[model samples]
Target: MATLRLYHAPISTCSQKVRLGLAEKELEFESVTLDLLAGDQHAPAYRKLNPDGVVPTLVDGDTVLTESTLINEFLDEAYPEPKLSPDGARERHAMRLWTHLVDAQLHPACRVVTSAIAMRPAQQRLDREQVLSDFAKVPDPALREMRISVFEHGVESPYFERALRSYVDVLETLESALSSNQSDYLVGSRLSLADLALVPYVLRLDHLGYSHLWQNERRPHLTAWYERLHLRSAYDAAIRAWEVAPAVEGMHAAGSAVHSRVDEILGRA
Candidate 1:
């Protein structure tokens, strides 16, 4: 077997996605944990492997893969038995579409909430200049600006409101999709890349104490889909362990304190 190594942070949603994919394939690999909160991801050595300096980088022999969705697809193709892609071209297209929605909509919104609620407060406790410097290290110019705004202003940042609204919209989309699909997984009756792509975001919703947004009597499909994900052993082995990280715990605690504010923003209050 070719050697496989993953560099990741425990609480990172992207990292969790990759981990779940690995676990589902019953793949054994070496783990290299990066302390994202401590600025480990921004180090020059790591940046060589991932120019964006993000977590959940998969290194298989000479090949280095970033981007959680792509990495998950790679894992699936590499180990086909518990296949993570659907059999037909149409189903595969749907799977890719779902993953695209996550990247295009859900992921950025999740980052805004995570930064505004959890990471911003944590950053405030650190050196201000260093925090700004860290924000500068983000490779994407637009994302860098958003991070800087949330870092400086926390909930008062304009992006927070946008993030809140975006999340609501995405949840509505997910609820409708799940209700209409009549499948436990996102794209088909079986678990596929689309399901793995989204599971981490669902876990993030729960961790952020925002589960009630879609866990109500009216959103049975969304609730049921989430529950089905948890029933998988890979969910616990690959994803759940990270939920208890000290940084993640701190974020969750911070998220709990802002429950009323978020509800008000979403008009759930």
Candidate 2:
């Protein structure tokens, strides 16, 4: 068996999910931390591993994988003990639905929200031309435009309101699922890829000082589910242990400053 090596950034939501998956499986791997803000992902050598210049790239010897969702599924398939995928085809399908939702909707929304809120302050401090240059380097035209818009406009960015609404819809969906389901975890009786996949996105909201989205009786079931997941040992090992305190603090401060704006956009104000 070849050793696994993971290239990731401490605060990236995708990286956190992969770490959570690895932790749940009790898998050990070599960690290569990337400094995303410093444009480390764009370096020529790192780009060879992932042309997308994204973090959370997993290398299992000759097999190299990109995309956090696929990497986690690979981990479960390769290490079947304490399986992350639920039993039964129906349950597995349900789990895949959640992961798909994350990949298709939540992930893009998360990037916009994080950039418009948590990352805006930092980006504001940098040289404007340099920021534009970095945004231009993003491979996807739409994504590059999103970065530039959020950097320039913060909560006022056209993307921000839609991103906030996407989160609201997701939280509502989570609340309904957790409230109706007999099991504590999503999809099945045990924690599955579904729960692991969504945890980091929820945690991102918490880290950004946006826990109000689910907390305070707003979405009690979602709040309870989130609390339960937070207590898991894997969360501490994979997320809390690797957290960069300063960056988190900055996010908190930046996010806190925009509470009114967020509330206004969400119609809570």
Candidate 3:
């Protein structure tokens, strides 16, 4: 077995993605828990590994890698058994793009609602003005330009709300995509990283009690995709011992499940 070290936190979507890949690879690692609740990620030594202060950093022998998608691709390509990626070039490209939409784009929509908008007390609902203000804080010039482009298209726009609605729409697109292919899996035949990528977000929906938001009445096919993943041992293992991302944005807490076989592999650390 390779010497693998994973730095992770339970409630993180990105961390969960990497965990799913590791489970699929059937590999073990030494896991060090980082308490994002304590802002431990910004502490000096840990930041050396990931300047971005993200969870689920992978250290494999001499190679230290971050970014869940890249790390998962690394695991899949390197191990190449019981694969989690699409095989052909075009198929892989589509998988990568849509996976981003599910994993990356839908992420903010889920977060904005959980973090700021709805999850708060009735007295503490996010201020509409502040929501727009939060939208305005993206200082990147390129990002500013991209937001401007959407407004120029004659669509109602701003950075955050526009971004949120786009992601919600992407779910509808996913529903249509699933509708055409009766198979529960995303690519040609079986589970791929695409399915894995989307599954975390599906569980996110369930955890958030947005389960009704996607299902037979709203988008039946997408609901089926969610159900297919719900049963997998691979995904089930990754999710065990994890917290549901907090209902209230900015508030973090300990969750119910403490550990699993994944924890056992790392626990022997």
Candidate 4:
């Protein structure tokens, strides 16, 4: 019952994740929109709130929470009516690991693709192929090898191509995780943070005009699961209500953790 405010950007998937989390809990909070495209987060006033200059700087009472995964976890635990995360320690850890992978690896690669593809003006395009070639630098040999076999699946190269690979990998893995012949949700056959984290990505896939790629013959189970989530009233309002221009292109839609968990998850020095 504390005063709550959210700093969000239309194009930010991370912010959207928090929005979905809050909505699922049925918590009513005020929303404040920030202009990420215009560099508003860099202003002196906002900098004091979040030095990182990110879209989702959540203000809960007097506490300011940055990071999408943390913020969403706080809402889940704080509200706790319709849980967004699971109960057991093992389930929680699994969810945390998946969230970290999506937030760290997939989201950044998606940004690289988006900035190169559509985030830039047509004439201003920075040559995505060159950008992708440059991506080979700070490289993880494992990701690079995965990136190659991924490209063989039939997608063009460049930054966005890597995004496509990551996207497909996520969807396929998720589909296989669902119950063999009967299940709707992602983890343990119930709605969890895993599903919520993924919904925004799926939403962006449609926004980017790649809806067909997720259709029947392509990823039937994944498509079905996404559609099922779309029917939830909370999902419809909290997550889908906002209008997004896509902070970047081809693949773009992208978290934080709770105060209590920070010391546990990140571990205090």
Candidate 5:
């Protein structure tokens, strides 16, 4: 087998999912970490691997994969010892639905929320004109414009409230699922691609000091499910080990500062 080479960014949610998948499979790979805030993804050389200029371009011999969800599915198919997917056809469909939701909805919401809360402070530290110049290079026009809006407006951006609501909806859905499911994992009795796909987003909220979304009696089932997953060694190796301390601290501070406002927006206040 040719060695796997992964081009990823440490703090990126997409990158985190792929890393978790690799860790679950116990596969070793050459890691090329990109500094996304520095526009490393925009470089011509990196763009060749991923035309979208996104983190997590996985290379396995001649097979190069782009989308993180697809990369994870490929990994499971290629190496299926302790399978990351479910056995039953219905369970498989359910798992795919979760991954699709992450790709189609949760991911966009996460980007906006992270930009509005965790990343805005760091972006502000850079020169304003340079920030605009860098964002202008983003391959997706809608994403580029959204980034500019979030950067300029932070939590005040119109996109922020909508994004935050998306998260609230996801949390409500998760709470309901966990409450109804027979297993601690999402789709079945064991960890599957579905749980791995959603964990990073949940972790992002926790990192941003938004654990109130699941903590306490508010969402007991979701809270317990998350705690159970957090105890796994793969979670520590893949996610916690890659966190940059300074960035985590900054996000916590920023999130804490806006807790009341976030609550207000969610009608919790």
Candidate 6:
């Protein structure tokens, strides 16, 4: 194994996914912790490695990889033993579809909702101006606006409602997927990249106080699927064991209100 180095933050879901991949492969690597709440990701030094200012940037020898799902694929391809990706083309496509759903839908919504309800309050306690300046450095214009809006108005911004809907849609999709399949994972019986891509999003949903969407009697398949994923040691080390901060505690409480609003909209209450 070429020297592997991962730059990540403690609570970042994308970082958690890559960590799960590495841990599952039993790969030894150096861990570089970035203070995301403190705006360390925007520092000049880190930007050279990943201009997007994202966590879980993987550096292997002279090669560098970004994007959590893509990074997981690269790791599996580079290290074949205990392969985390599937072999058959159809299965591979199925796995990629789940990853795509998460990267395209769940992740963006999770970002907006979590930042609005959970992260903004904590960040407000720090240097507000500096945080604004750091966020300005974000490469995507739309994302920059979303981040700023959540901070300025908290969950009252229209973006939060859209995000909440996206979260519900994702859970409903997961429930359907699990109901149609006999396998424990999103793609098949054996764990694959799809499961790795989704676990973090599900964890974020729970942390955001929205676990009731699938944890109840209505979505039994999703509930069982999550329980199966939880039993994995990699999930525990990468996600479950991390300590929650005071800001996140406040966010979780705030998120409960968001959940209630969503429940009313969906008529689940």
Model 5: how far is 230 from its true place, Å? Answer: 1.1
Off by over 4 Å in 2: none
TM-score, every prediction? 0.96, 0.98, 0.73, 0.74, 0.98, 0.93
Better of 5 and 6 by TM-score: 5
- Compose the digit string of candidate 3's lDDT tens values, residues 64-100: 9988888998999888998887678888888888667
lDDT of 2 by residue, 145-205 (tens): 8898899899999999999899779988999999999999998899998999998999898
Candidate 4 or 1, higher TM-score: 1
Residues 6-115, candidate 6, lDDT per residue (tens digit)?
A: 99987788998898898888887888999887778888999999999989799999999999999999989898778887778999999999989888988998998788
The lDDT of each candidate is 0.86, 0.91, 0.64, 0.65, 0.92, 0.84
Clashes of each: 0, 0, 1, 12, 0, 0
TM-score of 3: 0.73
Candidate 6 is scored at a TM of: 0.93
Error of 2 at 105 (Å): 0.5
Segments of candidate 6 deviating more than 4 angstroms: 244-250, 257-259, 262-269
Q: What is the C-alpha RMSD of each candidate to the true structure, in Å?
A: 1.3, 0.9, 11.0, 11.3, 0.9, 1.8
Q: Give, for candidate 5, the lowest lDDT window spanning 10 residues.
A: 118-127
Q: Candidate 2: give its CA RMSD in angstroms.
A: 0.9
* Candidate 4: 10-residue stretch with minimal lDDT: 253-262
| Per-residue alpha-carbon lDDT of candidate 4 for residues 214-257, written as tens digits (9 for 90 to 100) | 68567878788888888988877776577643433423321111
The alpha-carbon deviation from the true structure for residue 244 of candidate 4, after best TM-score superposition, in angstroms, is: 5.6
Root-mean-square deviation of candidate 6: 1.8
lDDT assessment of candidate 2: 0.91
Model 4 stretches with alpha carbons more than 4 Å out: 122-158, 179-182, 244-269
